[model samples]
Structures are given as structure tokens and as C-alpha cells.
Target: MPSFWSQKSKCLYFYFSGMMTKHKKCFIVGAALIIITNIFTVCVVKLTQDSQSFCPYGWIGFQNKCYYFSKEEGDWNSSKYNCSTQHADLTIIDNTEEMNFLRRYKCSSDHWIGLKMAKNRTGQWVDGAIFTKSFGMRGSEGCAYLSDDGAATARCYTERKWICRKKIH
Candidate 1:
């Protein structure tokens, strides 16, 4: 029969081996959890950064463009000149949504825009797009203004608040 001391030594060795195995499993599981959590946090941060890209301060962002509405009044030509100085142009209404946005956000009832009358008595936008004839522009005045009713032509010298538009960088 084995001596008592030898049997005791075997028991201690087996106990220590089992404990070490359990400890090693626990350590590996904990490490894996930490790595997974870090990866998830990184992914969330990247997604939020992409989604939060926005326009500059004091400008409204819409469809990848920025719009600025002036509080001070200026004539159509003066307003266009002012916008050109800032590397922008008077606001051009391309659709009903843009028209509605301007009407809603305009500082006053009359706001100068980029629309004008061409030599042929036809309406044209500053960007050289021909205005659709369906809008029923009545006056021979060269400049256009946004009013409560809709866009209407006015004399180019008439002073009014203006809207400017530029592309987002």
C-alpha cells in the first residue's frame, strides 16, 4: 500500500489541477466577452459619426444644400450681388417642396428670389432654367418675389428680404 504522505500528495496534485482548469476557462471566457464588447462599441461609434454629418451653423440644410435667409432688405439685383459675394446665389425654387419651404421660412411676406423675365417675356431662373409656363406670372416686372399667394413678379428695384442658396461641401 502507498504511504500516507504519498497518497496525500496525489490528492493535492489532482485538486490543484482541477482548480487550475476551472480558472483558465473562466479567464478565457472573460477575455472573449471584453473583446466582443469593445468591437460592438466601436461599430456603434462609427455609425453615429456617419449619420451625424450636418451643415454649418446659421444655415438650413436640405437635400445636401444650404440656404440662408437674410433679415435686412435689398433689391433683387443687390441681393443677387450680395449672394455672389458670399459664393452663393439667390434661392432657386426647383420643386413644390422647395417653394413651400421658402414660403414657410421667409422673414416677411415679400422675399426676393432668383427668378426674372427674359427678353422673350418668358420667366427664367438665375441658373438659366426656363420657368414652367403653368405658374401664371402676370406682371412684366423683371424680378420675382415670394408672397403669401405664391411667386409673383415685381420691379427689379423693389427692396425685400432675400434668400440665398449654396451647395454643401
Candidate 2:
């Protein structure tokens, strides 16, 4: 009887050992997957940071925010209204890159910008919580257009797509 019990114990030990060996492969695979996922996450973060650092179109990309030049014909009131409706504001050039991008499409004739005369007429800007500072200003051009030049304010009504800038989640 003692011999029979010893034999059963040995068999149990051997079975457990074999099962552990098979589980070793599973453990190794799981560890490898963890390492691979960590590496992939790091790479994705780095790539996103790089893209944000330098805007592809010379526009300033700041803290998940992007601005574009809008060249559409609209009155100051309408332009502000439009931007507000879209949950954005008129183009604001926060840095040199943004300024350069906007200048590239400047018109020979002054174009309307997000800025407007303050109600007091004291040269102060009147804003409806859209923008704190005027992004840019135009001279006597009641209408706006998206152009580097060669287009008049009257042509702004030609129904061209405009630039819209917003923040990324």
C-alpha cells in the first residue's frame, strides 16, 4: 500500500510539472505583449508631439490648438458671427509662423479682419467673447476674401472656401 501511494504522488508531481511548462509559454507571450504595447504607446506620443511642434502649413500649432487663414467675403459682424457659430474665432496670429502663413495670402487692398471698432469709438476693440485681441485689421474693406492678392473685395462674393481653425481634443 505504501508503494502504491508513493507512485500516485510521483505521478501528480510529474503532471503538475508538465502543466507548468506549458503555462511558461503563455507567461512569456504575455510579457512580450506588455513590452510591445509600451513601446508602441511611446512612439505614438512622440510622433504626435513632433507634428504639433511644427505645423505643416506654417500655421502655429499650440497646445492642441490650430488656426487657419479664412479668405471669405463677409462683413465684420457676419464674420464674427460665423466664427462664433463654428465655436471658433477669426484668425489669430500668435507666432511668426502664423503671421507668415497669413501674410502669404494678404491682399493688396486691405481686408477685414477679426478686429472692429469699439462701441465707444475710442479705437478700443469690441468683442463678444470671441477674441481678446484683434488678430489683424483691414482698411475700408467691408468684405473679406482668402487671397494673397489680385482679388478685389467685390470678388469676395465668388463663393470660395474659407479657412477655419480650432482646437484638437
- Name the best candidate (by TM-score): 1
lDDT of 1 by residue, 1-169 (tens): 2121224232222234234222224455568889999999999998878556555567788877778888889999999998888778998887788888878888456888888986577888889988886455666788988887888888899889888898765
Q: List candidate 1 stretches off by more than 4 Å.
A: 1-53
Name the lDDT value of residue 80 in candidate 2: 55
What TM-score quantifies how close candidate 2 is to the native fold? 0.44
Q: What is the C-alpha lDDT of each candidate?
A: 0.77, 0.47
List TM-score per model, in order.
0.65, 0.44
Which residue pairs come into collision in candidate 1? none
Kindly list the per-residue Cα lDDT of model 2 for residues 15-101, writing each as its tens digit: 342342222244555688899999999999999887665544634455466655455555555665676776666654445555456
* Candidate number achieving the greatest lDDT relative to the actual structure: 1
